[model samples]
Target chain A: MKPITKLTENEKKSALRIFWGQLRKVNRNVPEQDKIKFLKRIPFFELLKKHQLDEVARVVYEREYRDGEYIFEIDQPGAALFIIQSGEISVEIPTPKGEATQLAVISKNAFFGELALLDESPRSASARAIVPTKVLALFRKDLDKLNSTNPDITANIYKSLATIIGNRLKATNELIERKIKAVA
Target chain B: MSGSERSRKTRRIVVYSMTSIFFSILIAGIVYGLQPMILPFIIGAFLAYLFKPLANSFRGPAITKYIRAGALLFFVGSITYWGTTFIKASLPNEREKLQLKVRLQYRLNERYLSLMNLADGGKGNFIYKTLGQEFDELKKRVIDYVKMSDDERKRFLILQKEISDSDHENKKYYEYYLANLKNQKVDIEKLKSLAGSAIVAIEKPAGDDIGNLANIMRALSHWIILPLAFIFILLDKGQIFHFFLRLIPNRYFELAYTVAEKVDDALGKYIRGTMLECLLVGLTLFIGLFISGVELKMAIIIGMVGGLTNAIPFVGTFIACIMGVFYSLIAENVHSFLPFINENNLMIAVLAVVVIAHLLDNAIYQPLVVGSAVNIHPLVVILSVFGGSLMFGFAGMIFAIPTIVIIKVVTETLFAGLKDYRII
Candidate 1:
């Protein structure tokens, strides 16, 4: 019981099979229904009714990225918000000394580039896949189209966006103050 | 890395490239085989994309999306049905139409030859004016060199050679006319031959009775496939795009998706805006002509021609003007809304209608519907239209701009995206 062993090829294959099995189960559901449920879980869309979630799902685009592929680059004009469907993403920014800093590691069920939907601003940080990643992209124009059709869902998403931005602002302020204190 | 691993990767690359090549060849072969039946799908896809916003505008809690599509189909179907019935009731019978088609083709051929002769006449006003006695004779006799008796034509040619300019001394056209005038009368002869074969395709407006029922259904079936394709695309719920996206390898997935989105956005706006503007302009002309008491038949034809040509900016306006004045000049029952207007005055009225319609189009319709999306260099427009006409006839000419727009957007986006992704 106390002996340790390296994982064998057979065991690795079985683990991969199980992972794929779970993914297949996720995929086996009618795509529309699955997307509706998935969209409903997002904090931005959490307040949306089932039908409203269904409407939002219509314009959602699915994109997959290879490991190390950059989802977006710093200073690039952002056109869409990308929600991680399966794998991890890393958010990085350049420092004053020209070194990169990892701001956060975003995993499944999290979203990045949300600020793009609000305005045509360039991105502040770069995002790259940490692994083979599948993401659902909701484009800004699509969101505006949804706004015309379902103002309630668009309003809820925007409210969530506002809250998220507000929280980030407060955290950033605290971080700056702490840095100043440490310097003093 | 092991040699085996490197070998295996090389093999994979070869396999992928070979498979891609094979599939491309197969698809091309299939499309070539389906040439006759491809129009419907093309038309369907275009209409589907053009009408998508209208369908999108109708979504509500109570209404499912398909219901909205259905409502749009119903609306369009009803209008088409009414239009066809009106047209059928007013259209001339088969024999009358055939005669009219031949006459129109001949008249057009004569007019074209006249224009060509004027251009070639090269400031020889005396040579041009003596060929006719009346204004009508002026047009008819412009090509009179073609109709002259052999002896008279020979004399006419000799006289022309005597009076010809120094520029003509080097030219072989008059020399040919003088040397072997009758047998080598090629250009006008070729024009007549063309007028024979290219006469409006009314050869079998009412096909043989034996081919009626099943043949009619078969003809309708292909067109029906287009609308069905259109409907399925609208109701596809974005599955067509998803299907394509799914096929893209993970490495190129994001790049491909973004490029496709860009192409779709730009092309869709340009096409939809242009189409809506053309439809409105055509409708205005149709209404204007109808109220002005132009013959129903001529009015309908001119309306359609105006709509078709409206894709070309400056050229389209002048063409529409020429068509309106020409039709009014020839139409027997031409009257006008104004009491003082007669058949001759109707030409001016028609010209007024065309100018006003285009003015309104530029001021209101174009700005309101087309906007800046439809902008292209005039030279580019002319070249593309000519290229399209050379390649695929009338349909290609009509579709050239949209097709170019699609290719331009797709290639530009894909190249830019690939560079950004370091894929190529």
Candidate 2:
């Protein structure tokens, strides 16, 4: 009985060590502080209660795709807004000339699927993973439903969205202007 | 008529008969003037159709059937509570704002009249006064042109009569009338076109305005009726369904039941899914703003309105944005808790904040909410909504996309029986 008890203690120690090691491995790619900073940039989640934010963070998935993998196709309806978590994704738009041009390369922290959220518009452009890429997506339908039930959180999100749109328009115009000038 | 001609005539007669039946039913209802009370009930029934799933969810062993029923009741009660409270609370501020806006117009008008007087050879007017006067005169002149052009028909008719009658009197009068009439006619035509465009523009915004408010009320009403009706229906759903089933001719019993089931599913998915989507959006928005430390009541108000407004496809964005701005303005005015900044600076700050929030919503927020469920192509959705609004006024505009979605779903479902192809 004494020998069995000792063996059990040893086994427990080994199991604890293994668990710790696995946790370390999982967390090695992203530190807690960095995760907070990353989440800060996502405007929608900024106002989530500490507990709710934690719930989001826990479920937040990080997915990687190989270069040239289709992230989403134009006109393919999908749920979830993808935030470029790492690497780059190229946005391709078909010109009136009937050729696809790289309209933009969305980098880390950039997002897509907004037009879908406001209304169900088929995607205007196709997104291709330009490199090994990762994305964090939030489902609009789920989020909006939550908002109706919880007015306080909804209000915060509205403020965040208003500001984000204005800033993006400004930045996009600036980028386009620069591109035009360079070509000229 | 020939057999072919008779068939064509029969088809035309059938089509006209159906249309007239539909029109007459509505006209008859209106003739008796039962619309006001009936309208709300009809809307409520449609809503009950939409949120059938949510009502269904509040049933069965997964949740204690009693608890589920209570939950549904609670849902209805809460919606009523929040809706009335929000509207009641907001109405005063809204009225005050309107009053203030009117007063501001009146003040501007008074200043403008004085300035006009100064412009017309009124001496002893200072340089500042003259500048003010000039600005006022400019506005008056523009307004006069606008008002005059709006009534161009009467003006032109009178001018035409005068031109014909007076052409023989003074030669100068004839010459002047001819020139004035020619110029005025051209101006009048241009103004008419402008007015036509303006009418179109005004009609659009006005429809949206009514639709937006109606959407809020409608959404809130659904939250009430869906749960309430569902609970009662579930409690006696068997009886209700059986009674209808028994009423049906035995030959078409199964077909009728199946059609009812399909309608239930369509209404259920569309309404519940939409409601869920709106709620989620509102919550996410609220959480984001609170964490960001923005303290505007407008955010909450807008979020609520946005969730409600979001039911209208293509046009929802504009409605949501306008509501956001309006709420923000009210929030800024009513909340004195925040320290006062310069008024212009405060406006700029609010504007900046609003712009950023809208971007996040459009870019990141909206897609996450309704993207997966709404399969209609954006271009198609836009066109359908525009067409619907053109045809049926506000209600049509609001229901356009959803109706299209359901139609597409039904068409696909019906076709799927033929070949199992995905319609969406």
Candidate 3:
């Protein structure tokens, strides 16, 4: 019969060695640089460092939508922020006349559904793919998870999101001023 | 519709249906063939899921994957090492007790045989009666053979020697056998045969080896296979998930992915939370018992059991309480180590400790660890625990709540999706 005491010790040593070896290989294989590059292009993720971006990439999901497919419907619960990787997405709002009015055409490298990163609320407008589109989705649950572990990355993401929203609000204000000036 | 469009839709449906049927059969066959490995796979998957967050946390610039993996390996390895050492230390005492019990059982069987011989009026029982004159003739021939050689007689005497000669108290049965032999009607050969059969009956069962084999299997899986599988799963998590996603038809891929995400969210939180809760409860109870002056070893074992049983919802607390009381009483009666403490005092102390531990668990640990992850009603919790215990015993009871939560989340997501499509 084999000596169990000796066998157990040997197994423990071997398992640790194997695990360390595998972990090093896996770490080397992680595509951190690629993810960092992708995150750098988005305004919300631009403030994040390379390592911070890696943390964000861990929880983000990539999805492909066919042409003419609805990304989300109006008044649906907004739970995730979507960043456009390629192709075009059209945002539409229902007007008082009960007809769809185009809000904005979001193209490659832009993002939509920014409000979801802050709160759990319904979408104000619907977003649909104008062409076959690829987007990265960052959900609130994943964000909250990241918040617990890497608070710096999460805080930076929120800060960038706020800046983006502020910029959009200012642009909208400028457009309204222009419209009012024209009417006057 | 146009003719071309109608034909294309029909062809698409046929292809999808056929592919689904073929894949379903293939998956079923694979599952059936891999039945034995299913438990290890599940265990590995669970560990991978549980540690994923920790693994992800290591993605920061300061830490390398080697360091992260090493930390996890060290943590799990230490726990396993400690647990094995504890079991090893306790095993000798447990084995000794088992041997004592077996010896007592053997003695009881010997007494039973002696009683049967007494009931037969010392005529060597039914076997002697069946043999009749042949038995008498054989006994005489054996006596004659023994008388012919001194060495043969000595050997024959040694053969008839009492097996329990070391124990003075149990020598009465042997004396009774000697008295029966003195009676001419009793055949020596038949008595020897009966004694041999009794010895055979008292021999340890061969089933012990099978039990040991099972223990070895469990140990190997828990310590080796599980961790190895977990590492692989964590390393290839995205690939594995994508592989499953690729299996879905393009039309339903998005919906299926959403459903899977919801299920994963619910089940992951519930499972990880419950594990934390169990650990907290167990540690709290252990500390409480230790403070209350209970024996360290017994307290540790009972506390661990109580904590693990906490996974069974409402019933778990009750079981833990019962175990605490029973173990406390046993310690009180046997060890009597607590000076000037009577049974009532010990019982009261145990009850108070258990109650305080339960309160702490409910008020602090439960809210923090489990939160409102599983929002099932208390009534539903009770029914599920009972149903699970009835169906799958302990494992069922432990898993029932999480299983129900997954079902609830998936069905809600599906219904929501249907509502969005206006199909429900």
Among these predictions, the greatest TM-score belongs to 1
Model 3 ranges with Cα > 4 A deviation: A1-59, A95-99, B1-11, B54-62, B77-81, B84-225, B236-265, B291-293, B324-340, B389-395, B413-424
Question: What is the C-alpha interface RMSD of model 1?
Answer: 3.4
- How large a fraction of the reference contact set does each model reproduce? 0.32, 0.00, 0.05
Residue-level lDDT for B106 in candidate 1: 40
Cα misplacement distance, residue B314 of candidate 1 (Å): 4.0
Candidate 3 to truth, TM: 0.67
**Per-residue accuracy of model 2 over B286-378 as CA lDDT, tens digit each:** 444333333545557655765665555434445545654433332322332344533223334444444555565566655665545536676
Per-candidate TM-scores read 0.72, 0.38, 0.67
Expressed as tens digits, the lDDT of each residue in B1-424 for candidate 3 is: 7798689879989998998899999999988987656656676667778777778777754576556766776786688689889867755353234233333333333333453363344645676567646855754564443221333223334444533467654344345334434543446665455534422225667998899999998766655666677777776536676667667653454456667878887788888898888888888878776666667886787677788777766555676677667555434333344564554355566677778878988899889977967566778767887898899776577567877888888889888865653435
lDDT of 3: 0.69
**C-alpha RMSD values across all candidates:** 15.3, 25.5, 14.1
The numbered model that scores best in lDDT is 1
**What's candidate 1's DockQ score?**
0.20
Give lDDT tens digits, candidate 1, residues A1-184: 7898878999988987787557545744487778878888888888887657776887888887867878888876667899999999999998999987999998999999998898767788999999999899887877887788778889988998999999999999999999999999
Instruction: Give the C-alpha miss distance for residue A107 in model 3, angstroms.
Output: 3.0
Each model's lDDT: 0.73, 0.56, 0.69
